[model samples]
Target: EINEIIRHLNNSAPGSDNLSSFFFKDTIDYVASIITHLTNESSRTGQFPDILKEGKIIQLPEISNAINFSELRPITILTVLEKILEEFVYKQLIDYLDEKNSH
Candidate 1:
């Protein structure tokens, strides 16, 4: 899990939280345990923190190549913590699917 987070930190862009993966990656060793704890708490409670989900929507009309505002591509910049949660949830889903497939 830490490895996956680290991978994203190095390759992904900073989110609205203004916390870049590089920041966490460089300090992964120090924060990995804390993140793991938070991850577990979030799962056991079956609730994601409201703060983590607070992200900014970046609209890119030029990139979307559309004149209509609705046609613009919207990107979500999640907090670093939220990004980690997203990865953790993704892994859980993948594992569940793989387990079911093996049945």
Candidate 2:
């Protein structure tokens, strides 16, 4: 489900459209929502999966060394979330991003 969203966004490339700004904003919002959801779910369940557990710190240099967002699919996002939600800390990360993105 998540991979489908990424695939669709990449295939449609918002830059190609007159409504590129809107598309970009919507895409960002959608991606943010997914992140937010995963974080919240992870917090409640204490079941952060290995990948997300590995990505606990968003600012890690290792993150940059890991998979690139440009190459990520929705399924990847889902997998990451599945891993992340296994831990309780992911909620904090989601809250931070939500607060930042809200403004």
Candidate 3:
């Protein structure tokens, strides 16, 4: 799961926190243990840190660069940590499905 989470980190632009995926990629080992613990805790308690919930909603212009809000595409930029945890959840779900299908 750790490796899968690391693999899913995107090389996208940073958010307001100014944290890039590279930062997590470079220091994954140092944070892996804690991340694993957090994942387990979150899974058990159905809760996660509020910091992970922080995100930025940015609007991108449509094909014609229209000023109307309806023509803009909104994208949410979540923290790198959140992204990693999300990937962990995704892997867990996929593994569960695979195991079920093998039965």
TM-score of each: 0.80, 0.29, 0.86
In model 1, residue pairs whose N, Cα or C atoms come closer than 3 Å (at least 3 residues apart or on different chains), thus clashing, are 9-21
Q: Give the alpha carbon lDDT tens digit for every residue of 17-58 in model 2.
A: 223333434565466467557666755796654543332222
Residue 22 error, candidate 1, Å? 0.8
Each model's lDDT: 0.78, 0.43, 0.83
When 1 and 3 are scored with lDDT, the better candidate is: 3
Better of 1 and 2 by lDDT: 1
The alpha-carbon RMSD values of the candidates against the true structure, listed in the order shown, are 2.4, 13.4, 1.7
lDDT of candidate 2?
A: 0.43
Q: Which of candidates 2 and 3 reaches a greater lDDT?
A: 3
Query: CA lDDT of 3 in candidate 1?
Result: 59
Q: For candidate 1, write residues 1-98 as lDDT tens digits.
A: 85566667645667766787778888888888888888889889987777776888888785545888877878887777777777788889899999
TM-score of candidate 3 versus the correct structure, residues matched by position: 0.86
Which residue runs does candidate 3 get wrong by more than 4 Å? Answer: none
Candidates ranked, most accurate by lDDT first: 3, 1, 2
